[model samples]
Target: MSEENKLSVLVVGGGGVGTIVAVNLEAGGHAKVTLVLRSNFSKVSRDGFSIRSVDHGNLNGWRPHEVVDQVPAIGFGKPGFDTVVCCTKNIQDSTPSIEELIRPAVTPGYTTVVLIQNGLNIELPLVAQFPQNVILSGVSFMGSHEPEPGIIEHDFEDKLVVGAFRNPGTSAALSNARARDFVGHYSAGGKTVCEYTADANRSRWEKLVYNATMNPICAILRTDTATLRLSDSIENLVRPAMEEIRAAASANGYNLDASIAQRMIDMDPMEIFFKPSMCMDALKGNLIEFENLVGEPLRAGKKHGVAMPVLTVIYDMCKMLQWQLKAAREGRSQEDMLKVYDSGKP
Candidate 1:
């Protein structure tokens, strides 16, 4: 497809990362960026979104050409987007709804589905739905959030690595070319986009290691990345968890070096203050993506005879925390559980 024929783009999630990406795409001069919000978020009309990025300075006011709750029945009808970026959280129960929302934009020979979310499990299901078309998976290190409806705050500035997971070998030939082209376009327009490894599994595993180590701990303690990075007690807990993730990744045929984990932990702690997305979800009383981020890796590790006691403990704790938080949000008493975490009784 010629560059001119490429539909601007459609971003499915209207949360922090979604809004930031959409804003960046538009600011970079990509006009066809359409943000698809949930039907409940219909309040986010064509006025688009207002975003504030620490790195980009300020995007006080920004709007897209269209903002729809559901995909139009016409299936990429008029303002068809060349790329459909999925930034939804990985909640198993919500998969069907998300799939339905994604279907309309998957018109053959026109659009590519680029998933930019946490966890590694979303690739297969997404591909199962759109086999012939190009399905790309990406890992983002940027930290973003929506402080309120139609408003986003970008706290961290990081690079993005996009590639194909089904056929890792062919990712370079099949997706990298297009990815590079998109990256170049975005970069020219002042967005930070880069082509990292063609190996999606390795890339995903790398990010998983970082997530598994930081997200749960931060969520459980209600702290930011810096706290985790600076605290010896947190490090004691995080180091072991990261080690287990490394074991899991190694067992699953990915040769993740020990230094990768060290490098992630060793990064400057003060650069970013935003908490992990999982932590943010927990704060909002929303279900966390524990299964994919933590549970799946542990299961994969166990299947390969890898021991992950630290991860196992954190996983259980996070599950309980999520349950307690949900119950509290629903007006149930979580006093019993809070006593444990609050009084250091656990």
Candidate 2:
């Protein structure tokens, strides 16, 4: 395709996943990929990005063709992006919200917005606000993180399970060729494998099976995956929480298999020792990803009348931990704040 005919993709948030997508898409040499890096624009634009992928090996000076501070206004009769991938965190009550962050780039019928964030029901508000846009869901299994600004360390698996967010019991949005084509861009230069499912809700729910259990457990206990796996926490805390989430998903009309809970339990023995994002955030005195990860599931359970007692307790602990950690950041005594937990109070 000519430069004018090439598909344009704008990736918001130049973090780990955003860089991965931009680098791989640019590698394909097919689409015109641009990155919206708000903070690290000067460094990345000058020196480019660096990637240390366990699967793809070390790559230095990897840069996309275009880097801008913000989404440019789509001029009248001027072409807008064909795809907009959001890699930003969906923290609870975040400013500029996810919708406002990407609102400027959405072209309704033209742009396909792929949400590659974590948690449940993260797409509902966007779907409601931009009903004309082709919204797709993506569950990123890519084990990657940014240890420093403008650098990405991708370890272990690199795969994305993606599909259109059709209503429950509805067929996949395979008919949306744009969604299929967008998925293809991820693996354009063989960077990662992208699997398209007819039932994206199943994929999202399946991922929550692991996330709902591990994220809060680790953040609250100040532990890692290996710690949970090696001890009775797997059975006592993780497994029950996963089961409750699975039940909640089922009650919300997404029937996840009971075996998913066991699968997460079983896989813990072979996986790497690491802390989840929520745990890392808490340790670093950052805001916890409260709403989507735990709050949404709990509310869904209540709405559907499904009992999620174990997850309820975990959720409560996470809220308490969040407040205590926030106080610790503001020069409060960590020891005294921890005493709040000692009292067995919320």
Writing each residue's lDDT as its tens digit, candidate 1 over 157-193 gives 8467877657332344667666665665455456575
Provide the global lDDT of candidate 2 against the true structure.
0.79
Report how far off residue 159 is in candidate 2 (Å): 0.6
The per-candidate count of clashes, in order, stands at 0, 0
Tens digits of per-residue lDDT, candidate 2, 67-110, equal 99887667588778888889888877667888888888888656
Number of the top-ranking candidate, with TM-score as the measure: 2
**Candidate 2's error at 277, in angstroms?**
1.2
Regions of model 1 farther than 4 Å from truth: 1-6, 39-43, 46-48, 76-80, 95-97, 108-110, 167-172, 271-274, 328-346
Candidate 1 clash pair list: none
The models' CA-based lDDT, in order, is 0.73, 0.79
The superposed Cα distance between candidate 1 and the true structure at residue 67, in angstroms, equals 1.4
